[model samples]
Target: MPDSAGILPLPLFSSSLKRDTSRPVMLIGFQHQGNLGLGYLASTLREHGYSVLTCDFEAETSEIIESARQSKPMIVGFSLIFQFYIRKFDALMQALRAAGVDCHFTIGGHFPSLSHEETLRMLPELDSVVRFEGEMTLLELADVIGTGRDWHDLQGIAYRGTTGVVTNPMRSLVDDLDSLPYPERNFEPEKALGRKALPLLASRGCARTCSFCSIQTFYRTAPGKIVRTRKPAKVIEEMQAMHEERGISIFLFQDDDFPLFGPVWRRWAYDFVDCMHRSGLAQRVIWKINCRADAVEPEIFTAMRDAGLYLVYMGLESGNEEGLKTLHKQVSVEQNIRAVEMLKQVGLLFEFGFMMFDPGSTLESIKQNLRFLRTILNDGCAAAVFCRMLPYDGTPIKDELERAGRLLGDVCAPSYDFLDPRVSKMYNSLSQIVDVWGWIHGYRALSPQLNWAWNEVAIMERLYPGIDGLEEYRRRLAAVTKKSNDVLFSVMDNLLEVAEFDAAERWDNARLDALRREFLEELLRERDAFVEHNQSTMLRVLRAQPVQEAASA
Candidate 1:
């Protein structure tokens, strides 16, 4: 075991005119819970013959400052992903400045990739923000710093001096993704921030540009570059590393749309399946990956399952055909239905990530979505994790929201939690929908108290109760959910006293089991309730439609 010292040393670079010295580059992965970027970059840097250290940004403000004090490098990089993490990173730098620790600070990832200019303006302690794909840019930046050479030579950087943001053009995308080292095999995973399911990146950039997306915009920052992926051999190498080094077989593929780009991905999938067999990896492990509805063809979906993909996270963003069309989803309602059915036919498990309410959607539209979801869920692949449309900085929706004055203050990039005010405001709408939805399904496996409260209301209203309007219904549901969460947390707290698992693992298997059961139970009651409401609403609306048509006729 090595000390923090020499981990990211800023050895004064001896010029090539005198002698060449090694430059130490520290790749800081973002957030307290598992870092994929730094892990990848750490291995990348080490391969390039640079000293590298990877660390997670913790809640303790002193953590970065303390680490900086202990091992100050030529370049201190923070692997920023979400917008909230950027704010937290700013605070970390402020803490460091307060404590008198001055080291060259930098950041990269999704948020910074889009808002590098604003990031530099807001966070004064930051030296530069890497704009595009970071692996090469970061290495070059550290090289310049270690040598104390000209800053102008570095590409893909946004830095501030007396004149303010000096933006450099981003480097071209890595031509060959297969040439890069695997992050898991190259760096450490299954450690730090209490995450066991190693998050892996199979590819970079995206193929589609739906109106609500930022990935399309961000990827285009480096023009003419198509989405790139590592060879299947490399992907399996990382999995093998996870299995061998961390004993982690399960993974979460954090790709934007993994399976969509047909032939390239299929090659990787076949190689992956071959490696899984050759390496003797666990057959039962769940490796979840997300893809667009049109990406999973029946044959390809079957190939994926053959390769040991246990779960496919489908972003059936909206159930309504018009809503999907409005969002430029490119896939039709029929295509989505077929995709889900394909996954089911292959005997693979999956869950729905749905957006029931679009910005312009009304109550009627929501009911239509409910009917659509009911048909989809009828096949039993409907464990819903509701997500509202997130407006990223460079996305078209963000621009639209800004023009309409609906967006407030740097509300584009989501923070570390992926739930900022802008998005969470929508989440508030989602919560309302969830409550109504929960009332219909009983909120089982989702929110226990909500189920209990809704059930009580149902029982009360049935047994000779007056009308409990929306407000009264909401207040009672809130109280029930609050009480349920409190009891669950308290029980867990007592168990923790006697438990041997660390605080991070405390949120693992047992907790997930408890949460899931509660959610399912609550949802069962909610489903029945939803059915009743939906049928009534649909009949009324259907009758009204014919009457309006008759009048027009």
Candidate 2:
């Protein structure tokens, strides 16, 4: 039953706000990596009979303005995913206004909702900021705009009144996950290997309050249930529909905590596994999920693997006890190691989020983090990757840094100085080396390409099993990965030695540059060889398979 807003009685949208039903709403947001934020808002509006248009936030300003002109929507919404991109949004919106594409402009997401006044100050052209849980609120805003009524008193919104910005009372979070319509797929589905891939959500919100993460803060500040999950049957139904109707074989579970954390959620996981087996979808498709390190128990993960769980992404954010405590991760260093071991034992392909540098970082912590990465990745189980943590808006870490007077940089790119200055210099050198070889320009870089190629081989082995030379290919891929990891470890170790000795002036830039180039050349050559030989072979097997058949079939 919907409230007076003609949508579910979720927080934000009011019953008094009614749309014309025929008015078109336009949304502009980052579409990369299956952005379901805008997808849900678009779907909700469509459910209530309002036409919707979507434009990628990365599109050129002229292209976006052209889209607005062509669509002529009653209201144009912007999905601001990060506060760092505020300047980009400002310039684009300012351009749109100058071009006289004068539909109502609204922005929504973590930064805007948490700091609405600051957002308004940053992007003055925006008419309203749709605070947390925006489905109903956006629809109601559309309805009011369509009917030419005053939207000043709308709840779950912040707008500039005659005097200043007025924020309406916060709305309750949507209590039920199953009531909402499936998000509209406004873009082409992504692919894993050669199989069609899509991201699905079984739940919304996270229970943990990690200081560096905003997910908890985003859901906690809102009024309703914090971590609502759909029933197992409902989740399976969507998976089945996608598998049967859309030829999707890869399911990427985008849940913040993947509903697999504790005893209560373990029961939910078992039920979900049971449903997967009963529906026979488990045999046909492979899926992945993101969960906390503590959630990775051997028994339940084994069951999940049997039910088509292919990968697990854990937020193993830090390596040492002090680092974990600083980030408020709650889980210990031993727990993190145990979880990784458990995943390996269950035969799950695992990836992790590791922060090698943070405000609390010291020389000893840096050494410990590096050692941890080598311990995990020396065997070529997963690619070695690490990065510095940024203090994004709405996170407790950022607030803490501000209070400590340690925060540097602006909202566009929030950063902080490490407690030890030498650690900063070491990090900078490490960054320079990795940026040259690992992750600068995406596929053209070494580490990312290596990871992608490794993932492809893993997926191929699982999807099209018994392909000739597959094991040999896997062995060779592991060799390539190990070689690259060794070089990374070596380079970082040298930089750490330099930092330890305070040899700042004699940095040996030429030697490091040569090493980077030589390693990159070798890595790319190996990667290209693997792709050339194996990719087409796997594709041929895929092409030979019958349509709508199980992977093992």
Candidate 3:
């Protein structure tokens, strides 16, 4: 039990028997992109003398059970990153329990942290939730569980109490992000054209309050500074170490909003760029970041480009003013266009998050969005992509929809209808079409594959510059991409027309499928040919050999 100061007294070790430190604490989560949340938690626990093991949640049930049977973990924690996976995780939890691995179960992430009551009710297997900013909280929970002490009074925890689900007071956010150790990377680094790419964070939280995003609210609800940044020197030091030790050449900044927000952070960005140059890493590595459209100013962005900024991902959530206003993006359509133009002007590549359909969307608005995509993507600077805005949990838009009694679907997959029923029909059909062909991971997706091929060309331009046919390869890839974009826009145009006339049934999907197939075949053939032609260069790059300038152009 905790004392009057609300802190638990140290657990006294038994004279005869001590807690077995061999029993590890297991963390299970979706490790598709190397989940930093679990990485930080594992590192934190290890820092305080605890053994940690992790398993991908997508692993087979039998495999997970086998691992648990072998490791015999004392506690099993789930990283419930998104609500969509709630049902899946519940199934895993049930399976683990049925296998007789009766360890203390716990979960964490945005959904469980924000809606603890519902989470507790949904996954009754959980012993507690290590809520927002889980490093210290999880560490404390591990200590108490290891020593067999009661943890009901622990801050930043929500558990099933006697009367109901009781959420204790939240812990303050970590003030100095630099104080925390680097995330323990257990998964393989992502590859961008034979160059190793790893995700890095320069800051913790975002300052903007986009209606559809819970990041701002997640940090604001906590009891500390909203956004905390590590010093540029420390960030460079980490980069230097990773580059020297791991041969990592690409860094993906996964900050919610990178520290390029306003005047204060502009200075930080400059300092970061300067550090990159001073540490001599500016020319050695390239990186990408996610930022708002309005944050893409010319001077700073160009400076960033000079300092290894290869790609920028802007949240251009909407095309028109009305849609932007509804999404609370606080930026105009012109600004979005200008941001793309500025990126192009400075010779930096970019991708964007565009919502073609929102709650207030109509046929006209959808068409406006289509035109906007054309405006930016006509040159084939990047792949054409768009998605319906999802009203995720703890977002203002979710609350707004709930108050108006328009929110539909289950909590795991919440959705709503557009204002017009015809628009709904249109979107429903469009979504099916996209899922078939244009979706990033769709079976027939062509644009993203081409986009990746183009990314390889770009990477080669930097790392293997002056290769014999690099320029020609880039030009051919660009032409193929522009043609693919043309096909996408044509299909969208036909869909819009069909929806307007209420003839979605008559929409010729066979013709579109044939076109996508042709492009996909061509893409594969072209990529294979290029690889065969550049066999020596490809082999050298794939083997991670030192880059050497070719004899001649």
Candidates in order, TM-scores: namely 0.70, 0.92, 0.92
Q: How big is the positional error of residue 436 in model 1, measured in Å on the Cα after superposition?
A: 12
For this target, which candidate reaches the highest lDDT against the unseen true structure? 2
- lDDT tens string, model 1, 296-353? 7777667666655767777788777777876778888888888888876876655556
- Give the poorly placed runs of model 1, Cα more than 4 Å off: 1-24, 31-33, 184-196, 278-286, 379-381, 412-553
Error of 1 at 320 (Å): 0.9
Worst 10 residues of 2 by lDDT: 3-12
Clashing pairs for predicted structure model 3, backbone only: none
Q: After superposition, how far is residue 193 of candidate 2 from its true place, in Å?
A: 3.0
In candidate 1, clashing pairs total 27
Quote the positional error of residue 371 for candidate 1 in Å. Answer: 1.7
Each prediction's whole-model lDDT (CA): 0.60, 0.82, 0.82
Q: Return the candidate ranking by lDDT, descending.
A: 2, 3, 1
Give per-model CA RMSD: 17.3, 3.7, 4.7
Stretches of candidate 3 off by over 4 Å are: 1-22, 432-434, 437-444, 502-506, 538-553
lDDT of 3 at 462: 65
